[model samples]
Target: MSGAMRMLAGLYRPVESQTPYGGRSVTFEAMGSAWLACGARRRSERGEGDEHHAVETMSAETRDDPRLETGRVLRFGGADWGIVTVRPLRPGRVGLELERRR
Candidate 1:
């Protein structure tokens, strides 16, 4: 599913993951090129706790995705972002509401 979808997708960007390697160590792995939305959190409507901080909702494909999880850290566009919520959008796709982690 991803192979065909990736080939057909026009916009692609980079996603980096930090995984715990041996309980006491961490390793950063680069998963090249993903289809995602990266931008400022919408101001039209927001829930409690969202208004105070600058955040963004990043949506990406879920199929074969191992980089997104609760408490997981990701680097996009040279900044660190923490995974706040990973929501399944539809077949072969998912949406990640990320909070900027400084």
Candidate 2:
């Protein structure tokens, strides 16, 4: 697989959300990182379809030593979104939050 794909896939973590039935619910995974912008293409179009510029940087390391990055996307989700912080929780776990634009 491509380097970026491998990186993205490696970020997947098993997720088990709370259920009202007091039983295990859907078995899925959560993305270790959001605001992904490594592969975004730049454009000069001024219309609504024009792409915005993005910037990112290495954030922290997982318990398994896998590196993570904070991606920043300008003008996304109807606002400027950025991975502002990353905190290591434990081996193979991390907490990430977005930095609100002012």
- Weakest 10 consecutive residues of candidate 1 by summed lDDT: 4-13
Q: Please give each candidate's TM-score.
A: 0.45, 0.27
User: Per-residue lDDT tens digits of candidate 1, residues 3-75?
Assistant: 3222112222334454566344345444444455543444233447745544455444444365556666566
**lDDT digits (tens) for residues 21-93 of candidate 2:** 7877644343444333233222232324565444332332223333344553223334433455666766666
Model 2 clash tally, residue pairs:
2
**Any runs in candidate 2 off by more than 4 Å, and if so which?**
1-67, 71-80
Candidate 1 backbone overlaps, count: 0
Instruction: Tell me the deviation in Å of residue 95 in model 2.
Output: 0.8
Position 64, candidate 2: lDDT:
36
Identify the leading candidate in terms of TM-score.
Answer: 1
lDDT scores in order: 0.50, 0.40
